[model samples]
Target chain A: MYAFNYHRPASLAEAARLLASNPEAKLLAGGQTYIPTLKQRLARPSDVIDIGGLAELKGITEEAGGVTIGAAVRHAEVAGSALVRRLIPALASLAEGIGDPQVRNRGTLGGSIANNDPAADYPAAVVGLGATVRTSKGRAIAGDAFFTGMFETALEPDEIVTAVHFPKPEKAAYAKFPNPASRYAIVGVFLAKTASGIRVAVTGAAPCVFRATALEQALAASWSAASIDSVTIDPSNLNSDIHAQADYRAHLVKVMAKRALAAAG
Target chain B: MRISMTVNGRAVSGEVEPRTLLVEFLRNQLGLTGTHVGCDTSQCGCCVVHVDGVSAKSCTMLAVQADGCSVTTIEGLAQGGKLHPLQQAFHEHHGLQCGFCTPGMIMSAADLLQRNPDPTEHEVREWLEGNLCRCTGYHNIVKAILAAAQTMRGMAKAAE
Candidate 1:
């Protein structure tokens, strides 16, 4: 990792000040992705602000018929939390199915969504459940508007994500075809029946997590796995690499969506 | 940066670069060579250790990040000069060949058993996903973990 000054700010205000003063300072949440990037010399920030220990940014709270999870809450904590399991077992399952025990232990929800890796599992959940991303600036961006593109979000440079509020879904499930080696989703799908509507979010299939509108519509008409069986997925915009072809990814998207729906049921 | 942490049971403090990994700090600075670094990319769980009594990849974490946190490495597993139950079980079950991944596998398995005592074989296998053992095919390792869980349970019952 590159040599950079590390600052452990006790408060979000201090962290924001550090980021504002030092234009190149990066907030270190879990260091799961950022550390690796630094080690590879991919990024060279002037300062690294550590928010891992900030008490204000670490917790899960059930309120207003939804669960609000702090940004610094680790994946392992979410996976192990009885509250998360009781409120949203599918979210707990999704957290459990992330990278491995060790990775889950250290990877934070804030870091995961902020990095916005195209293949990440959390994006599917965030978009599928229509979660609200709350930033330090007291802005609440809807899940649909938060994710802009691959490795991109609506967050400004210094703006920090404080918490994510996920409404209680009638039923929700996430299914992923993970790469054997990395355990990242080759094509993951998250299905949820919410008060707003039935939502289907597909991850690791394109530049960013996207809603499968056709599948969502089909499921809305009839909440069944077979409902979207004939709904064709377009391969034109899907990702194609050595792991899988565009057409293959499109096919996996459909399969995973169906699986997610069945699992949700 | 000067950071202090409880390793094993002793509080140790040292000056280290901000970018230094916890594994590097543990092995190089603290001379705790039991935590090995097989894959620096965090894929291999060779550097698995307990941070604040929970299993974490030391290689993926910065030494500075471990400030004021208690860490436990494989070297700390044995108590009173006796092998930990997991270690003994591994030996009895012939869980290793090259011994390269033993330390990490033992640590990860220990954490798993702590969380879920008397875990099923499937649970043990799933828990070992992060810890890779190319030599053993994980057959003996799984057996060792199960055996250790049984022994630990028996010991706990006797103590109770």
Candidate 2:
């Protein structure tokens, strides 16, 4: 990593102010992705604003309606959280399934969502569960609109994700086939409830995580394993990386969706 | 950066560079060479340590990030010149060969045992998926952890 000025701000406003001051600044979260990028010299920011020390950015909160997770909370904490296990075992299981223990211990939700790795696991949950992304800029992003493209989000350069609000779904599950080496999802599916109806989000399939409209509609009619078994996804725009081809990923999406439905049951 | 952390039951402080990782701080600054850095990416558990009682990878975390936090490393597990049960079990069961991954393997297993004392074979295997052991095929390591669990259980019963 190149030599850069590091700032540990005690408050969010100060961090935001620091970001506003330096347009080339980067917010340092879990560093699962960013740190490696920095080491590879892929990203060389003049200022690194370390967000790990911000107390407001950590912890799990379960409220009367739903759960609001501080963005910087570690994946291990989410996986082991008693509150999450009781309310959303699917989310806990998903966290537990992400990468290895090291990745889970150091990776943060804010970092994962912001980095938007094509194989990441959080995008599925954020989309399928109808979660909301709250930013330090005081803006809230609906999951659908939050993810724009591969590694691209609605976040502007100066904004930081402060928290993620997961609306407690009636039932939900996430199933994924991880790239054995990187532990990234080869094809992942998240099944959950939305205010409108049931939603199924697929990640590691396309340029970004997306909802399978056909599967969602089918499952809406009959929320069952059989309902998803018949749904065939089009593979025109899926990702074909080293893990798998577009067709293989497409096949995995359907298979994972059925498994997710089965797990949800 | 001036960082202070309670490491392995000792309160230690060090002035580190901003880019210094917690693993570097522990191994380089404090001369606690138990932790190893296998991959710069956080994929490997070779740098795992307990941060405030929770197992965390020291490589991905910065020393400055650990300020005021309590840390327990592989060195902290032993007491009074006696080996930890996990260490003893690993030693007896041939849990490692080159010993490159033993510290991390033991660190992660200690955490798993703390969480679930008597884990099923599947549970042990699932929990240990994070700690990769290239040398040992994990058969003996699993046996060791299970044996350690039984030994601890016997110790608990004997004390009663």
Candidate 3:
């Protein structure tokens, strides 16, 4: 990795100030993705602002109708949190299934959604549960609007994600056909019955997490896996790479959605 | 930049480049070579070490990030010239072939045992998803971890 100035800001205000001042700076949360990108020389930044130590972006709180998870909270903490397990077990299970135990120990929720990797697991939860992303700029982006494209987000260059608020769903479950080698989702689906209606979010099959409106509508009519048996996913826009062909991914989307629906029951 | 931290129960300080990884600092700067680097990518667990009592990939973490933190590498597992129980179990079960992945495998297993003292065979396999053992087919590695967990549990029961 190339040499750069490292800054560990103590507070959110300091972090925002540093970000605004350093145009060529990158925020380092877990460094799970950033470190490797640096090692490969994919990115060169004048400064690296480490936000893992920020006190304001830490903790898991249960509010009136939802759970607020601090941005810097590690995956292991979320997977093991009793409050999370009791409130949103599906989210906890998703966290438990991320990269690995070692990766979970360091990787943070804020970093995952902020980076917005196409194959990441948290995106499924964030989008499926219709969560709200709080930022250092004091704006809350709806989860649906947060992820824009592959490795892209609706976040400004200097905006820092502070927390994610997920409203408790009536019933929710996630099922993924994980890549055996890396544990990333090859085709994953998160099914949720929220106050608004039924939600069916699919990840790893596309460039970004997307709601399967057909599956959602089918499930809204009948809350059963069999209801979506004939729901067909279009393969033209899905991801086709060395891991899986787009047609195969489209097929897996339906299969995974059924599995998630079954699990949610 | 200058950073200070506790490694293997010893307070250590060093001046390093901002991009230096924790594994590089341990192996090159501090001469604690027990921590191996099999795959620099986060997928491999060869560089697993306990940071603040949790297992993490040292290669993916910057040395500056570990500042003021307590770190335990493979070299720190044994105490008073005695091997940790996991080490003994690996020896008996022939858990490794090339021994290239032993340090990380042991460290990752140590973290698992710390959190779940009594893990089933399936649980051991699940917890070791990040650890890749090309040789020995992971059968012996899994056996070694389960045996070590049983031995550690027995030791704890005896003390109680």
Candidate 4:
């Protein structure tokens, strides 16, 4: 990796100040994604602000309302936490099933969400669960508005995700078609309940994670896997990578949704 | 860059380049070769280590990020001429062959057992997915962890 300045600010305010001072600075969360990009020379920045040790960005809290997961919490924590299992077992299972044990132990929720990898599993859960992403800039972004495209997000350069709020869902499940090697989702589906109603989100299909309105309408009327039998998602907007073609992803959207629905039961 | 960390109960310090990865710092500067680096990307687990008791891919972390944290490597598993239960079971079970993936497997396994002591075989396989072993097909590796869990339980019973 090319040489760069490293800073570990003690507080979020300090971290934000550092970013404001140097507009080209990048926050180092778990480094599972960014470090690789750096080593590959995919991205070069003036400085890296390490946030792995930021205490405010760590923890799993379950209160009367919902679960507020610290943005920097590792995937392993979500998969193994007692609170996550009891509150949202499917969410825990989804985390547990993410890229091998090492990745889960090292990759952070904020990092994965911020990078908005099209094949990542967390985006499905975030959108389907109708979560709120709270940033260091004191701005809250809904999951629908957070993601824009592959390797892209609505996050500003100066904004840092401090925490993500997952409102408790009545019935939620996530199913993914993992790459045989990389374990990234070829297509993943997250089905969940929200105050507005039910939401079905798809990832690894299009340039960004998106909602499946067709499936959601069916499920809202009848919360069963069979309810989505007639629904057919269009593939025009889906992405085609080495893992699968657009047609395959279009097909996976329904199959995985049914599986997730069955699993949710 | 100059940084200090409590490595396996010992205070270690080093001066390194700004882009020095934690794994490179440990192996090149500190001479803790037990923490191997398998892949440049964070995909491989051969560089896994404990940063403040949680398993993290050292290759992905910058050395300076670990300035004030605690780290535990494969070398730390054995103490006072004794081996960790996992190490003993691995030796007895032939959990390793080429040994290239041993350190990372050990680090990842320790973290897994810490979180779930009585993990199922499927869970073990799932957890070990990040740490790739091109040898032994991971049969003995899983066996060693199961045996270590039993040995740990026996030791706990004896202590009681």
Best by DockQ: 3
What are the per-model C-alpha RMSD values against the true structure? 0.8, 1.9, 0.8, 1.7
Return the lDDT, model 2, position B53: 80
lDDT of 1 by residue, A157-245 (tens): 99999999999999999999999888899999999999999999989999999999999899888887678887999999999999999
Point out the worst 10-residue segment of candidate 1 chain A by lDDT.
A221-230
Residues B53-87, model 1: lDDT tens digits: 99998989999999999999999999999999999
What is candidate 4's lDDT per residue for A1-265, written digit by digit as tens?
A: 8778988889988998999899778888888888888999888889889887789999999866678899889998899899999988888988987887767767899999998998899999899999999999888899899998888888888889999998888888999988878888899999987677989999888888999999999998888767888788888899887778898899999999999988888
- List per-prediction Cα lDDT, in the order shown: 0.93, 0.87, 0.94, 0.88
lDDT of 3 by residue, A1-265 (tens): 7789999988999999999999999999988888999999999999999999788999999986679999999999999999999999999999999998988988999999999999999999999999999999899999999999999999999999999999999999999999999889999999999999999889999999999999998888888767888677889999989999999999999898888888887
- Where is the poorest 10-residue window by lDDT in model 2 chain A? A98-107
The order by descending DockQ is 3, 1, 4, 2
Clashing pairs in 3: none
By lDDT, the better pick of 1 and 3 is 3
Q: lDDT by residue for model 4 over B4-121, one digit each (tens)?
A: 9999899999888768999999999888999988877787789999998988889988888888899999999898989999999899999999999999988888988887878888
Off by over 4 Å in 2: B156-160
Clashing pairs in 2: none
Docking quality level of the chain pair in candidate 4: medium
lDDT of 2 by residue, A93-141 (tens): 9999887776787789999999898889999999999889999989999
Please give the distance, in angstroms, between residue B14's alpha carbon in candidate 1 and its true position after superposition: 0.9
Off by over 4 Å in 4: none
Q: Please give fnat for model 1.
A: 0.85
| Cα-based lDDT at residue A167, candidate 3 | 94
Q: Report the Cα lDDT for candidate 2.
A: 0.87
Model 4 steric clash pairs: A100-B130
